[model samples]
Target: MKFSVFQLSRRGARARNEDRIGYCYTREACLLVLADGMGGHAAGDVAAQIALNSVCALFQARATPLLDDAPGFLAEALLHAHRQILRHAQQHHLADAPRTTLVVALLQQGQAWWIHCGDSRLYLARAGALLARTRDHSFRAMAERSGQPPASVNRNLLFTCLGSPSLPISDQAGPWPLARGDRLLLCSDGLWDALGETELLALLAHDPVSLCVPRLVDRALQHTGASSDNVSAIALEWEMPGAQSAPDSISTDALEGDAFESTLQLDAPDLPEPAPPVPALPEDELSEAAIERTIAEINAAIRRPGERRR
Candidate 1:
């Protein structure tokens, strides 16, 4: 099997880029991760970076090359990341406890396994329709399931996430069998909240990550305007054996099975163009006091009822 992956991050309209980090790695198979930090100031950034780094490092160290135990490996990686985030927060006297949303995808032996926490999502598409997705661990999901009014379930507030020692760390995974011409997308809420499955499938229909990712980002930004949150996207396309005879190859659309059809589309808006970059603060410019203030605000917001709505 052959795969392609790409990642990009921008600060959005915020004064600082709290959005954190994203990564895509394929050894025997593929591992894609997106982490959105949730502390104040750059603490969110720190928390996100820590969680992602820890996850990748643990996966590399513990997971076997062929990934026979991919699910266990992913779960352990998430647990390690959670611990690392807690350690970092304790080491520093940051006022707010840091947290993050994590989404991971691993492809092995023609099968895919994914796990996630919070709102970042994983979507699988085949022949221009969504096959499956990971549901968000947010208040909105609960309210929707409970038959509350759609308007009552605010999308911003999370019910559970990584980093908090109080909440049970979520460890969820499932297998996704793959075939030729299947597409997988892993992204942060910033991107999916604006764009729907149809738009994503259409953008990825005939392109590689190099072309499709930017278009997805550009479209999300265009639709959301400057107020949009930080945007990150990773697209994976499966190529069958003997399908890459030429520099550019387009394969015939063969159905994997009748498990999914080609008519499903998510009812969401298009994305907008990306905003200008936020100036990065100098190393010395990030003072401990400033970090503390940010952490405090972040903690207060997390404790409140609506901080997650944004």
Candidate 2:
């Protein structure tokens, strides 16, 4: 099993790029991470770097060739990142804690598994169709699922995130089978919010991720212009056995150094939030009764009004 990767990050009108992305691998396993930082400039970048560093440590601690439990490892690593953020803030005595939205993907034994907190997302496309994508942990996203979104809601208002008082709400999935021509794309809202899913799918459907990734990023920026928000993207393609991949390493420093401009940053609410919303279950994908029950559960998860997504 072999895969290819293409990733890039731009500052996007901000003083510094807060989005961080990296991938590390041994012969049998590989880890992919994308983090979009919130809070202040320096703080947000710090939080994102901490998360990536935390993952690097976890990856090193586990068997490089293979992990015993990929899912469990992902869970612990994310929690570790969350704790690191908290620990950093307390130790430094900062007024506002740095927060972040994180998405991590682990690939092993021809399978994919991932976890996400906040809007940073992982999308899997197989044979030109969307296999799965992580949902955002935002108020607008919840209201949309419940079929009663407010007339005017800020879609970017994230209710859960790393460094918040409450544990960040995370969604996990997969062990999705991999096939030739499968494309896995992970990005921050700066990229996704600027471009719709349909556009993403269409762009990712092309060949040689090296070519596809830049095209995708360029396309995402076409509409946003100077206001583009730290745009970052990583794309991967699984090819036949013995497919060659170069030894590559990505770090937060590279992300911050890249030159792309847009005024975008992560923002989280300080007020107490309702319950954690259940992911919107699709009625077309499931039975009517099941969808109803899921909605009931989601409503129960929330205690008050929520934000919206664009």
Candidate 3:
């Protein structure tokens, strides 16, 4: 399989960039990761950097050799990072425990495996349609699944995450067989919460990550009024010169278009008034609950089964 990878990070309207770190590496296969740090000042940044560094370092040192068990290897790496983050938080007397959201993707032999925690996301797209996405570990998600109006759930509650000693760590990894022309996106909540999958597909269809990354971040900043949070995104595209067309291509396009138009229509009724741009929250004001709520909604949307309808 032939593949291309790209990543981008930006401090959007924030006094300090809290967005931590991201990485993409291709050896016998490809691995991509995105981590969004949570904490005050440089603490969040430190946590995120450490998480990514630790995971990548472990994968290189111990996991790469076990390519046949990439899913298990990646899961173990994530758990290792979680423990390391907790250790660092304790070592330093940070006012807030340093924590982060992590998303990882491993693609090998026309198959992919991924694991995630918190609100960070992993999206798989083929022929302009999202094939699968990871669910967020947040209270809002749990409530909605148990039959609550998603809109009624408070957005600021996380049921699980990294860095919290009490948060349950999940090593559940999703494995899917891939084909040529498949794309994988890993992003922080700062980006995915602002740009829905429809918009994401449209953007990716237009260009590779080198262009899509900045465009997505720009849209988020523009729509959110340049919120101070750091935004990071990593995209991987798999293309084979003569691979067969994806079976879901046609239906996926229809579904993607319908979803896009619906969102546009919903936003349209409230448009034309030239509403003021929403400002990005201050680092101190960042509400994990609100981000978690958005993530819950996304998880639900991805889980719903139907033809891509416009």
Candidate 4:
């Protein structure tokens, strides 16, 4: 497993940066994550950090070289992160939970899988053009897609995010085969909001991530000047085995089966908590309505594969 990767974050005009980005890898899998803390909420930075920590911890535990169910793992990890954020709010007795946008990309088995909630995004590019990217869970994006006037919609107004009261609605895509020069980028809204897609593509297509990422952040800061939001991005260029590695390239060939590597910084709040048990169902459990109700209940109750009910 070899790839060139780069990540950058800037405070811009904000008092403090609430955005977070990081990556981790095992011999057969890589996990890239980005989270943008919503400035309107309290403890936004904490929410962003919790999101990264929960997801990376799960990756370290499950990616014993590679995940057996990439898509399923993506979904579960996202939900787990959301729950962790809620737990933080509960523990702190906050009036409202801190909120954040999240995006994650998992590279393994010669393909890629991704998931996102809210405005943070993942872009997959090959041969210059943008091949794919996640859709933002904001009214602005939905309005544009529905052919409505997006100008009237507030771009920062997102309808879903981690740490919200309800289950966050997220999108997932994957198993897309990797090409030798394929590029994947995970970023906060701050970066994309300041720069156009054309500018982003040009930079990504022409240089390695280590080069493009810094340039991208610089240009975004220039575009918004003193009022720029917190800009952050992490990107990587996929390379086939035995390919010439970039200056900042990583090779996991020497790692043992149980070894794990990561750039994410984990702290006390990042620790995993035991999931609550699902209450036993009554006699009508087989009813269709009951089944619909229990789906969410079961998801909330089960944390990991084969976790014992307590």
List the lowest-lDDT window of 10 residues for candidate 3: 260-269
Order of models, best TM-score first:
4, 2, 1, 3
lDDT (Cα, tens digit) per residue for candidate 4, span 1-310: 9998877788888888888787878789999989888999998998998788677766766666678999999999899889889987999898899999999999998899999999998889998799999999999999999999999999999999999999999999988999898999888887888889999899888877878998998999999998999888989899999988877788989987557666642211222222332333343343434533443443343333443211
| lDDT of predicted model 1 | 0.62
lDDT of each: 0.62, 0.70, 0.60, 0.81
Candidate 3 structure quality by residue, lDDT tens digits, 130-247:
7888877777877777887788776546666677767545645566887766788887777877777788778876565567667887787677784535667777777663555433
Judged by whole-model lDDT over C-alpha atoms, candidate 3 comes out at 0.60
For candidate 2, write residues 1-310 as lDDT tens digits.
Answer: 4777777777666666788776656556667788999844347877886776566445544533478898898898898888878877889998767999999988878889999999998999986799898988988888888887545668888889887878888888988888866889989898888888898888888767777777877777777888778888878787655544434312112222111111111222222133232333332444334533543443343335555310
Angstrom error of the Cα, residue 138, model 2: value is 0.4
Question: What RMSD value applies to candidate 3?
Answer: 15.6
Position 153, candidate 2: lDDT? 66
Assess the local accuracy of residue 114 in candidate 3 as a C-alpha lDDT between 0 and 100. 85
- Cand. 2 TM to true fold: 0.77
Please identify model 1 stretches exceeding 4 Å from their true place.
Answer: 20-27, 39-42, 168-171, 245-310
* Residue 252 local lDDT, model 2: 17
